[model samples]
Target: MNSGMDPHSEISRNLRAVYQEVESEEIPAHFLDLLEQLDAAERSQSKKDTE
Candidate 1:
């Protein structure tokens, strides 16, 4: 059943708008610190696996 408007296009437009809004926001400092901690843990694990 065609509704005369493409639902897929409407969804794509909404998703793009949401993405643009999110991209403009600043990341919190605490979140950045957490991410850095995670990266360090991953690197430590990788070094252990190689040895």
Candidate 2:
């Protein structure tokens, strides 16, 4: 189970980190898409788990 902190906030923080790296041109385009997909999947799974 997830802990005390807000899941959306955690997701936002992780997305922010990815954005910072992408802004620096550190991550590739395909990798960025992959991460986005993964984030989407995680959110979907979390929703299912909550239900």
Candidate 3:
């Protein structure tokens, strides 16, 4: 724990590593479905705007 590095930089580096680990995991099926629904809604809105 005492590598002579500043504590703030060490903490930030650790937090970023943890976040990258989480970001690499697969997203849940439910969340993917919700994202698809949002995309569909945006397309629908675009079509309405064009009309």
Question: Which candidate leads in lDDT?
Answer: 3
> lDDT ranking from best to worst?
3, 1, 2
- For candidate 1, the C-alpha RMSD (Å) to the true structure equals 4.5
| Lowest summed lDDT window (length 10), candidate 2 | 1-10
Q: Which stretches of candidate 2 lie over 4 Å from their true place?
A: 1-26
Model 2 residue pairs with clashes: none
* lDDT tens digits, residue span 1-51, model 3: 786766479787898789999998899899999999999999999999999
Each model's C-alpha lDDT? 0.89, 0.86, 0.90
lDDT of 1 by residue, 8-50 (tens): 7978789878998988889988999999999999999999999
What's the CA error at residue 23 for candidate 2, in Å?
A: 12
The best candidate in terms of TM-score: 3
RMSD in order of candidates:
4.5, 15.0, 5.6
Off by over 4 Å in 1: 1-23
Instruction: Pick out the ten consecutive residues of candidate 1 with the lowest summed lDDT.
Output: 3-12
